[model samples]
Target: MPQQNMGDFTLYFLAFDHGQNYQAMSPEERNKERFTREGVLELTHNHGTESDPSFAGYASGNSDPGRGFGHIAITVDNVEESCARFESLGVKFKKRPQDGRMRDIAFILDPDGYWIEIVPNKLKL
Candidate 1:
């Protein structure tokens, strides 16, 4: 369990690997036919696919730092309000919204220097 009593807090979405038994794949195995974004989206939804406009990458260390697969998407009730609070607290986001999909996206580093993406979900149409 996470330690109780917090000064500041943040939560992000986690996508689970469906247990294809990655250990079975030897280091020598190459990805000649890895799943594409559309193929992944068509099958299920969770991890950032190649086609997701809102996808953002983080730099987590690995033997091959580029090989780690995971991203955390924080949910915000009101993104603008959250931004104002963050600004007041002097936490400048490393990245800000650019496209329509990122209408309310922001980023801040965790205590361990991990990039956590703050994402505000769109209101249902």
Candidate 2:
């Protein structure tokens, strides 16, 4: 698995594409298709070196949004800019930054309908 060093924390992102036609596509095609999907580019971080490349697996099985699991949170450098970029990419939003009382954050849905909360790098009380 590839690793990303973020200050004191090390994070790893393991992505799995379970599209209905995933098994029909070649590895290279799968890689190319992954980037063409909405919200993928924004969610993916730096792929590790060749020795330990980022793992992107494909499966024919479908993925239903998990129950009892809350949304995943991502901290970005700028909330407004990030939201704008996400919107431009046609990512579905559960809650826009200015939609509710909590105007500082936003919620976006992944291809699998999983909610992802976007926050600022620094939280202001």
Per-model TM-score, in order, reads 0.40, 0.47
The 0-to-1 C-alpha lDDT of every candidate, in the order given, reads 0.49, 0.66
lDDT (Cα, 0-100) at 58 in candidate 2? 28
Task: Give the backbone clash total of model 1.
Answer: 0
As a whole number from 0 to 100, the lDDT of residue 87 in candidate 1 is 70
Candidate 2 at 47: error in angstroms?
Answer: 22
In model 1, which regions exceed 4 Å deviation?
Answer: 1-65, 98-101, 123-125
Q: Which 10-residue window in model 2 sums to the lowest lDDT? A: 57-66
How close to the true structure is residue 91 of candidate 2, measured as C-alpha lDDT? 96
What are the clash counts of all predictions, listed in order?
0, 0
Best by lDDT: 2
User: Which residue pairs clash in candidate 2?
Assistant: none
User: What's the CA error at residue 30 for candidate 1, in Å?
Assistant: 43
Write candidate 2's Cα lDDT for 6-41 as tens digits: 654455434434443655777667657665664342
